[model samples]
Target: MSTKRDIIEQLEKNYLFAVIRGKSFQDAFEIAKASYEGGIKNIEVTFTTPNADKTIEKLSEYFGDTDMVIGAGTVIDDITARIAILAGANFIVSPNFSPSVSEICNRYTIPYLPGCGTVTEIANAMATGVEIAKIFPGGILGAGFIKDVHGPIPNIELMPSGGVNLENMDTWVNNGAWAVGIGSALTKDITSDDYTSVTTIAQKFSDKLKEIRSNN
Candidate 1:
């Protein structure tokens, strides 16, 4: 078993999370496999998909020995968080922060990345030991939001999800985002059943991130 610190380090080092949401288990698995092949070490399977728990389980078991980290996303409550944990989720993410969910993740020693739109929400989540907070609908929040948040609380790590693409990812990173979650942008090719295209896009993003970090 990996300690919470190990997973946190992996998350920071890898820096890219491919948010996978598919119509079925096979769909999500194929997307995840392709993303991994393209060098994305972190995969977040959202609960909106059918049988999401099963998908997480299969992905965890298949890549259990690899450096890949699997997490459960869109977790709305403690019940769902517990279910995902029992299914082998390395971390739990929510659209918003919830104390019950945070407690469950704490009990299991798994990272809880809850979404926070304001400094108050971020501070409250951090007060309960959340190390990283997700900025949902990041398109609207923009990179400036991150800079603004860090101005006061320099220790908090923020991850922006949604509206993250190759063109603007650098801006987010430049503003000090710990990581960025790419969902539709990363999985768009899956709609055409073109798994190879998915891998290519993932690789493009991976390479882009490397270039950004190298320059920084």
Candidate 2:
């Protein structure tokens, strides 16, 4: 497995974080693996997925030995964070900031990306050594929000998720997103039994991200 620092760097460099939120562990695992095959090295399996810990464990065991990084998402508290960490999660992500969660992750030297909707939230999360803040519900907040936040905190790293699709993903990166969390956009119409579309979309997303990076 890569070091925590390496995992953090990968997320920034790749600019693509595949969010795996499925109904079951089997389903999420396959989706995550398909995304990985599609070239997304950073994956986040939400805790809301049934047997999330097992999914994390399975994926971690599979990808931990490679350059791929897998993490736990939707972690709301310190306990959940710790559970995921021990389950071999390379990092932790939450919908909102939690000091306890941050503290625990800090103790493990694990990277934490907490959801932040405003400049104040971003600043606070950054103060806790969080490398990147997520502009959650990015669709509602819009790519412009990232630009607006970056105006003053130009040095802060931000990854916007939610409502991010091929149509508008470029907008976010163009506006100053360090990375992005793709959910339904990447998995739309994809099911465990039908993953060919998942791979197809993943490749499109990966190519789009590369194209955007070249322009930047």
Candidate 3:
């Protein structure tokens, strides 16, 4: 089993979270496999999918056997959080912070990346042992918001989601983002039945992240 610290270190080192929302299990699995090949170790399966649990299960069974790690995204409550963990989710991510969700993740000893917009929410989430807090719809806040909040609490780790792409990826990492969650920019090719494109995009993001990490 991978320890919490191990997963945390991997996230910090990789600096990229491949956010995936599959319409079906096969689609999700294919996308995940492509991502793994492209060097994305962290994958987030959103709950809104038709059979998200099963998708996570399949992913965990396949990717968990290797160095890759899986997480549950769009997790709304404690019930869903527990379900995802039992199904083999190594981490939990929510669009917004929830006390119940955080508590459940704590019980499992898994990392939680709950969304927080304001300083107060971030502080509250930090109190619950959340090492990283996600800024949803990151385009709205942009890099300025991250610099502003991080200026005060330099220790707080942040990940931006909802508008991240290859073009602006550097801005987020340069601004001190522990990682960035990429969605359509990484998986949009799946729609055209062109899975190879997924791998190409994933590799591009991974390479870019590594380049910035090296420079910094």
Better of 1 and 3 by TM-score: 1
List model 3 lDDT by residue over 86-187, tens digit each. Answer: 999989999999999999988888889999889899999998888899997798889777898988988888999988888888888788788889888887
lDDT per residue for candidate 1 within 1-216, as digits (tens), equals 468898899998889999998889889999999999998989999999889999999998999999899999999999999999999999999999999999999999999999999999999999999999999879989989999999899999999998799999999999989999989887765556779988999999999999998999
Residue clash pairs of candidate 2: none
Error of 1 at 136 (Å): 1.1
Taking all chains together, each candidate's TM-score versus the true structure is: 0.97, 0.94, 0.94
Cα lDDT for residue 159, candidate 3: 93
**Alpha-carbon deviation at 185 in model 3, angstroms:** 0.5
Local distance difference test, per candidate? 0.92, 0.86, 0.86
Q: Which stretches of candidate 2 lie over 4 Å from their true place?
A: 1-3
lDDT of 3 at 199: 92
**Among all candidates shown, the one with the greatest TM-score:** 1
